[model samples]
Target: MSTFIAAFLFLLVFFLLMSIGYLIKRKAVQGSCGGLGVLGIEKACDCDEPCDRRKAKDAKEKARQERLAQHRII
Candidate 1:
C-alpha cells in the first residue's frame, strides 16, 4: 500500500542521516573537556590520572618561581 511505502521511505531517510552523523563524529578529533578550552576555561581530564596539561603548567610555574627566588638574592 502507499502508506507502507511512505513509512518505509521516512525510516530510510532517518537512518541515512543518522549514519552520516555517526561517520562525521568518528572522523572528528575528540576534545578532552567537551570544548571548555575553547571558552577559556580549564578542562579537567576524565581519566583517573592527572591531566598532562595541568602537570605541565604546574611545572612551568614552579620553575618561574624558582628563577624569581634566585634573582631576589641580588
Candidate 2:
C-alpha cells in the first residue's frame, strides 16, 4: 500500500508539471518548426509542406507591405 501511494504521488506530480508546461507553451510560444531540431519533437509539425503559422505570418507581412505602399506619397 505504501509503495502504491508513493507511485501515485509521483505520477500526480509529474502530470501536474506537464500540464503547467503545456499551458505555458500554449500562451508564450509562437511559430512551428517542421524538422526534428533542437526545440523538441513536440514543437515540430508532421506536415510535408509549410506549416499554417508560417503561412499566416507571410500573409500578414504581405498585407502590411501593401498597406505601406498605399500610404507612400511619391
Candidate 3:
C-alpha cells in the first residue's frame, strides 16, 4: 500500500539520520577526550623526547626516600 511504503521510507530515513548523528557525536567525543594519561589528562605534560625510563625511576625513588626521611624527623 502507499501508506505502508511511505511509513517504511520515513522510518528508514529517520534511523539513517540517527546513525549518522551518533557517529559524528562519537568522533567529537574521541577528539576532545583523547587517550588516557597516567596522572591526569589536564595536567599531563608532553615532552619533546621520550623520558629516560631508568633515570626517571631512580630520581623518583630518591625523592620518595628523601621525603620519607624528612617525615621521620618530624
Of the candidates shown, which would achieve the greatest TM-score relative to the real structure?
2
For residues 1-74, write the lDDT of model 3, one tens digit per residue.
99999999999999888789877664332444455554455423455454688559768989998997888633
Off by over 4 Å in 1: 27-74
User: Top model by lDDT, which number?
Assistant: 1
Please give the ranking of all candidate structures by lDDT, highest first, separated by commas.
Answer: 1, 2, 3
Model 2 earns a TM-score of 0.37
Clashes of each: 0, 0, 0
For candidate 1, write residues 4-61 as lDDT tens digits.
9999999999988878987766444456766766766564554456678878987898
Root-mean-square deviation per candidate = 15.8, 11.3, 16.9
Of 2 and 3, the candidate ahead on TM-score is 2
User: What's the lDDT for all of these models?
Assistant: 0.77, 0.75, 0.70
lDDT (C-alpha) at residue 59 in model 2: 87
